[model samples]
Target: MAERKLLAGHAIRRLRRQLGLSQVAMAEALDMSPSYLNLIERNQRPVSAAVLLRLAEAYDFDPRKLNAAAPGGGADAVRRRLSDPLFADLAIDRHQLEEWLAGAPDGAEAFARAYDRMGGGAAPGAAPDAEAAVRREIERWRNHFPDLDAVAEALADELRMGAGDLYGAMAERLRVKHQLSVRILPAEVMPGLTRRLDLHARQLQLSEMLDPSSRSFALAEQLAQEARGEIDALVRGAALDRLGERMYRRHLTGYFAAALTMPYARFLRACEASGYDVALLERRFGASWEQIAHRLTTLHRVGARGLPFFLLRVDRAGQVSKRLAGASAAPLAEGAGTCPLWNVYEAFARPDELLTQLVALEDGSRWFTMTRCVRRHGMRVGGVAARFAVTLGLTTGAAGPLAAAAGVALEGAAVPIGLGCRACTRPDCPQRSAAPTGRTRVMPERETGASPFGFAAD
Candidate 1:
C-alpha cells in the first residue's frame, strides 16, 4: 500500500510546498475543508476533478501539471514509455499504468527504473537470447562465406565509377535496354517522382531542381534494385538479424554501385589527396555529403587503406537513419545509436548550416563529426515534401592519415551533440525534453531558459 501510494503522496506535498500554499490556504481556494485537503495531500484520498479544478482556479496552475502528480504511472504515459523496448521484461499494464500516473508527478520514479534496466542483462537467468541470436546468425553467415570478403573485395575493385557516373550508367541501362527515357522534369511535373524506376516503360525521371549530389544518390539507389540478385548472393546461407540483413543487403548493393563509379583504388587515392574534406570530396566525385560519408566508412573493407570509420545520420527527432562502419566493429542496434551530446541535433535548428562536434563514446572512443541538414523533393506541381538532416562522423585517430596534407590540427578535436532526448544521458543539456533518470542536471533552473529542460553545464 505504501509503495503504491508513494509517488502521489510525494507529488501533492511537493506541489503544495512549491506553491507556498498551506493546507488552510489550499482548502479555501478549492472550497474544501482543511482536513480534506490534508488527506488528499497525504495520499489518503485520490485527487478528484473537483479538487483539481479548484486548485487550478485558485493557483493559476495547469490541470495537466496537477495530474502529473498522479500515482502508479499514468496509462498513456506508461504505454509511451514502454514503447522504448527497454521495459520488455516488466509485466506492465501499460494503459492502466499510464492512466494511474496521468497528470501526476510525471512518473519521474518510473523513468528512473526504465533507465537503470536498459543496459542491464535481460530478466534473471535468461541468456540475452536476442543478442545471442543476432550474433549467431551474423557469425553463421560469416562462416558460410569464407569467400564473402573476397567477393566484396572483387566487386569493390571492379566498380570504379563515381556516384553520378555510376547512376548515369543505370539510367543508360534503363533507357537503352528497356526503352525508357530519362527526363528531368521540374518539381511541378513529377512532384512525387524522386526517382521512380518505371518498370513498365523502363524510364527513370527525376525533378529538374534536384541537386546534383541527390540526383546521383537517387540514381545509385535505382541501380541497387537492378543489381539485387548479385547482392543477395553475397550473404547467401548466412544468418542476419532482420535489421542487419536489410542493412547488409542494401549496403552491398549501394556499395557495388559506388565502386562502379568511384572504383576502390582511385577513390582511396583521391580521398587521401583531398584530406578527406567532405565538401572537396563532393566536388571531386559529384556525390552528396551523405554518399561521401557512406563511402568514407566503407574504406575499412579488407585491403583498403587507413583507420576504421563509423558513419551516423540523425534527423530532427534524433532518430538515426544510417549507421555503418569502415573499421570499428561496434554492434549495430537501433537503441545503441543514440548519444545525447552528439551535435547532430543542433544541425536541424540551423538548416543548411555545417557544424562540427567531438563526441566521446561510453568506452572512451572519440569521434569527429560534421553535421548539416539536407532535404530533397519539397516543392512540386503540388505535394507534401521530404525534409531531413544527415550527420557524418569519423574517428579523430583515423582521420589523420586520410585527411589532406593541409596544416589544420585534427587531433583531440570534436563538437558535442546528442542523439535524442530519450536516449541521451548528458545532464544539463538545455535541449533535453525530459530529465533522463539518475543523471544530474548541470544548468541552473530558469523561468525561461533556452534549453527545454532548463539545464546548464556543471
Candidate 2:
C-alpha cells in the first residue's frame, strides 16, 4: 500500500499559532525555508515526516496527532452538517468548505461552534448563566486535560492503592503533605455542606451524609488543589465572570479529582478489560454511577482511550444537571437539545437500573446509549431524595465491543429523535411541547393529522 502524503497544512499552521510563532520564526525554528513552510501552510505542498519530527521535538507535541487522526475528518463533518435540510438552500460545495478550513481553521471552528450554540432554530437570547458557561468551557475542550491526567497518573502510582482504599489513600496524602486529617461528622454539624476544610484545625470534615463514593470524591477534590498552579493557569485563561470563574474553578477541581482517583491509564485499562461493565467499575474504583460516568468522559489521553462516551444527567423536571463528552461533539451535548424521547428521561421510571437503547439523531448518526437513575451526593441523605438520571452513550459503530451492541442492528431497533422542541423541526412528534420556530402548527379542526399537532412541511 502507498503511504499517503501528509497534506495537513491547517494542522501545521494551527500548531505554529498555538506556540505563538510567526511563519518565518517557525520555519527558522524547524530549520526549514520560509517558502517551503508557506507552501505547507497554504496546502500547496505536503509536509515531510522529517519536518513533522522536528516540530514535535521542538514544541513537545505528540507526532501521531500532528495530522489530527484523519486530516480531512473535520472538513468531512462540516460538509455533512451543512447538508442538513436547514442549510439545503445554501451553496455547500466541498471545495469552498475545504478552502475555508485551510484558510482559517480557527475561524472555521468558531463558526461551527456558533452554529451549534444556535439550539435548533431559536434566535440568540440572553447570556449564559455560570453553569452554562462552565459546561461550555468543559465541553469545548472535550472535558479532558492531558496535563492534569499525566500529573495525576504519576501521583496515583506513588500512592500504590488497594481496592476500597481511595479515601484512606488520598486522606493520608493530605495528612502527610498538607497536615489535614479526614474527619466524618454528623449531618447536623455540617448542615447543608458535604465537605469543609478547617485550615485552623488542619482537618477536613465530611458529613455522614456522603456515601463511600461521595466521601472519596470529596477527598479527591481537596487533594486536587495540590495541582493549584496548573489548574489556576487553565482557569485564568478562560473568559468568565467572577461567579462564573469561581464555578469553573470548582468544576476543574472535580475534574482533577476524578483524574487523580481514577488515573487515566489505569482506568482506561479497566474499562477496556471489562467492556465498560459499570457495575464492576463501580466496585473496582469505589465510584458511584455519576462519578465513574463522569470519569468516562475524560478518557481522552493520546494512544490510550476508552469508548468516546457522552455523559448527561437530567432531573425529573427535565432540567439538565450536567453534560460531558469525550471524543465526540454529540448533539445531546447541547444543554437545550435534550430530546424528551431520550432514554435518559425513561431511566427515571426505574431508579438505579440501567436502560440501554439505540437511537438515531436527525443527522443519521446512530448511538448506543445507557441511562441509569442516580442520586445527588450519593445514597438518599436523611431521606431527602434528590433524584437525577445519568446517560452514557457513544456512536453505535464505535460501541461494537460493548455488550449492549452484541445483537443491536440499527435497521429494526433504532428510535428516531431530534434535538429538542424549538430546535427540533419534527412537527409530527407527539411529545413536542413547543412549536418549532418559523413553522406554523397545522392542527385539523375535526381530527388530528399524522400527530396530535401537525405542522407545515419545510
Candidate 3:
C-alpha cells in the first residue's frame, strides 16, 4: 500500500497566521526556502517527515495535528451523526463530504452540532438524551482537553510539589485560599454521599468510606470547581443545552481532577518511561486503576505525547458505562451492548487480574486491549462493593512501542470480535446473540449449524 500524502496546507497557513510570521520568516524558522514553504502552504507539495520534525522543533507542534487527515475530526463527527438509524436510508458521498470538511471545517462542525441538537431528526425540538449528547461531545474531542491540561500545569507549577505531596498541598491551598474547612465524616452520617460542600459554613465534607486515593481525588475536584472561569472558557460555545451544560461541567470537573492528580508534563514523562504500566502508574501517582486508565486517554499534548489509547468501562452485564477514544479505532455505540467476546466482560470472572488480548474487529483492524475488574467502593471485606471492568485499547500501530517495552508479541492470531451482535457481520461467530442489522436470517429446517444464527451470505 502507498503511504497517504499529508497535504495540510490549510493547517500550515493557519498556524503561520496565528504566530504572526511572514512566509519568509516561517520558512527560515523551519530552515526551508520561502518558495518551498509557499508551495507547501498552497497544497502544491506534501509535507515531508523532515519538515514535520522541523516544525515540531520550531513551533512545538504535534505532527499529527498538521496531517491533513487530522483535520477531518469535524468530518468524523458528521459521519457519526449520519450513522444514526434516523438517516439509515440517506445515500451520502464520502469524497464530497471530505471535500466540504476540508474546505470549511468550522461549517462542518457547526452542522454536526446542529444535527446533534436536533437529535438527527427533522424536528428542532427532538433533543437527544442530555447525558448521551454530552458524552458524544466529549468523544468528539477525543476526551483530551488541552485547556484543562494547561490549567493543571499552571496549578502544579504554583504548588511546586511532587505527586506524593499533592494531596497535602491541595488541602493547604483550599484552607488558605478558599477559607474552607475540610472534614471527613463517618459513612453512617454521610450515607450515599462521597463529597459535599456546605457553603454557609464554608465546610467541605468527605465520606470516611472513601479510600485515600478517592479522598485525594475529591479534594482535587473541589479545587477544580473553584476554577469556574477556566471551566466556563472550556465549555463556552460547545452548543450544549442546559442539561448538557451541567453534564459537561461534571465531566470537566473529572478531567481537571485527573489532570491535577497526574500533572501533564510529569505524568506524561513517567508514563512513557514506565511503558504505561497501569499498576506502576497507580502506585507512583497514588491513583486507582480506573483513574490511571482514564488519565491515559488524555495524553494528547501537542509536542510531547504518550501512546494514543482508548479506555472503556463496562459492567458484568456487558453494558458500556463509559468510553473515551483517542482516535478512530472503533465506533463505541452509546447505550448499546458490547460483544461478549470482549475481555472487558470476561475480566469479571477473574476479578483484579490483568487480562490482555489482541482482538480483530469486523473491519479487520486489530487492537491490543487490557482489561481488569475494579472495585469502586471500599475494599473492606464483608462490605457491599460496586465493581466495574475497565479496558484500555490501542491500535496495533500505536501498540508497537509499548508492546516492545512490555515484551508482548503482536504476531499471534487475534481474537475475532465486533461492536455488538446487532451491528456485527461476522457469520461464524458462535457468541453472537442477535442477528446483524439489515441481514436476513435463514432458519434451518433440517439440521442446526455450528453457529446460532444462520444468515444468507452476502
Best by TM-score: 2
The residue-by-residue lDDT of candidate 2 on 1-458, one tens digit each, is 02556677877877888789899999998998999999998888877878878987888866645434222236644553454445644656768887887787777766555554453223578443566556555654567777778777877887764434666778888889989999999877887788899999999999887888888888888888778887887687566678878998998888888888888888888988888888888899888878888888888765576778888888888777677755666766653557878777877779857898988877678888989998676333356778888889988878887765567674457888876776567657878877664467777778865565566765
Per-model lDDT = 0.53, 0.74, 0.75
Of 1 and 3, the candidate ranking higher by lDDT: 3
Candidate 3 residues 153-268, lDDT tens each?
78877776433487788888899999987898887788678889999989889888889899999999999966678689657735677888988998899999999889999898
Where is model 2 poorest over a 10-residue stretch in terms of lDDT? Answer: 64-73
Per-residue lDDT tens digits of candidate 1, residues 1-458?
21233224456567778889887886777788999877776556777756666767776766433333333223322343443435433547645554444334445445523332332224555433333333233322221122333343453343334233455665665565557677777666765555566667656777787777677666656555555565675545233446656656655656655654555566778877666777887887787777776676555433445445556666666666554533343322223346555566677678877776656643345665667777654365455455566755556665555443234366555444433454454554665676543335555445555555643322
Better of 1 and 2 by lDDT: 2
The TM-score of candidate 3 is: 0.79
Candidate 1 TM-score, true structure as reference: 0.53
Error of 2 at 138 (Å): 2.5
Candidate 3 lDDT: 0.75
Off by over 4 Å in 1: 1-170, 177-180, 185-191, 221-229, 238-251, 329-340, 381-385, 402-458
Ranking by TM-score: 2, 3, 1
Stretches of model 3 off by over 4 angstroms after superposition? 1-73, 78-97, 103-111, 114-127, 161-164, 332-336, 378-384, 403-405
Q: How close is candidate 2 to the true structure, as a TM-score?
A: 0.83
